[model samples]
Target: MKASTKNVIKSIAVLSVIALVCVAILSLANVFLKKEVTLDKATVKFLNEKFATTAPTTTGTDSDTAYNEDYFVMLTDGELSNASGYTYKSFKSNSSNYVSAIYYAQKGANEGVYYIESVSVGYQNPISVVVSFVIDNGDFSIQNIAVKEQREDFGDRKTQVLNPETFFYYVSLVKSDEDMNITDADIIAATGATTKKSVAGLNRAVTRAIDTMNKIYTKSDEIKAEINKRGGQNG
Candidate 1:
């Protein structure tokens, strides 16, 4: 065949491959379009699932969803002034660790428990997760991490940090975010996907939650900053 003819043939092949890839992507988009996943619904569903294993004990509340804002109060100077007396306090985040909101579980059997809501960036969109902490005698322990939203550019695989069998399984064994990143580095490596930014994003949020809780509960430097912010707001 002539060189020009060969070039034409190669162009055709390349076009065909591009067409096929486009079709495949469109097909996936169509399938995802068929299902509508809203953030609030997903959040509620995650909380419902988390609450199921929890026994109903809080007055006028029966499920884990009861831990919502209506059930728990936000932290104020009163709480800050008497921080030592309070074991848990909830506050809003200013994007620190990708955290948007943090709540304290003050209900029965849930005391010393905290819920940190992080909207971490994934491959393209944001991955919303609620990290829970169960503190005992000043020692904080992570418990049941609920990933409520995964709006990624590549569609939701729900396997990165959300994988319970692998990633989450290892995370469950970790007590602190530092341990998750350092002390239990082997475990995180064993879980795999730590190298991915989505996984790193999740880790960042978790670390922030753990660090924030530690600082808040222990009256760390963060307390001073938060107080200053709150004071400015009041002023």
Candidate 2:
């Protein structure tokens, strides 16, 4: 073969090898990176364990029926908190869409539970979180709180907001009627996450939800009165 022919063949062979190597590396990285972006089996189980409840069985039934389906009764348009008419907000982020919802149950077996789920902007991406506030069925004093899902990343270091124990410990400091005083220092101490962006974002979002709830509770009398007026009209 001519010298030029041999040179072109060698160049083609080198390019082929480089292409194959690049594809292999990408495939390998995808295996691990994909799991981080989506919800995993553990997170699903945690969400159910925290928010799931059983349905009430009828009389003469030996087995208790689990009311897992249709358990959450969303507040109606007029019943929604003063924040917005809908319980859930489709919040659009810079690159992705995050959701924030507020659900309440008053006349069911799951009464006294106020479900709040939100996604707040974090260090690198949006942190999806779900919190369950237990009430006394008559008042808004949160008896307990539970975090269902929290996904956050910071540079090369990811946060453990999904870790049930640690996440709960940090959330315990937040109260229903009281204002959250979670400072940058507090977040760094508790979560070891980003204090400037991630922590602040989470704090502001969570605090706003809490404040909205407080406003609803404080005006419970008026809201209930309106509900009664509507009920009387329907009847």
Overall lDDT per candidate, in order of appearance: 0.53, 0.50
Cα lDDT for residue 133, candidate 2: 58
lDDT (C-alpha) at residue 137 in model 2? 50
Q: Could you give me the TM-score of model 2 versus the true structure?
A: 0.53
Residue-wise C-alpha lDDT for candidate 1, range 1-235, written one tens digit per residue: 9999999999999999999999999999998785432224334334435533435332235444543433332345364545533332343344334555555443445544566666656555566677776666756666667666665424444434456567555456454434555433544465754436666566655665666666565553343344345432321
Clash count in backbone of candidate 1? 0
What C-alpha lDDT does candidate 2 achieve relative to the native structure?
A: 0.50
Off by over 4 Å in 1: 1-48, 51-61, 64-70, 74-96, 153-159, 164-167, 176-178, 183-188, 192-195, 219-235
**lDDT by residue for model 2 (4-111), tens:** 999999999999999999999999998878632222334333433554434222111222121232323344445553434333332333233343555443334444
Task: Report model 1's TM-score to 2 decimal places.
Answer: 0.53
TM-score of each: 0.53, 0.53
Go through the candidates in order and give the C-alpha RMSD of each one to the true structure.
Answer: 10.9, 10.5
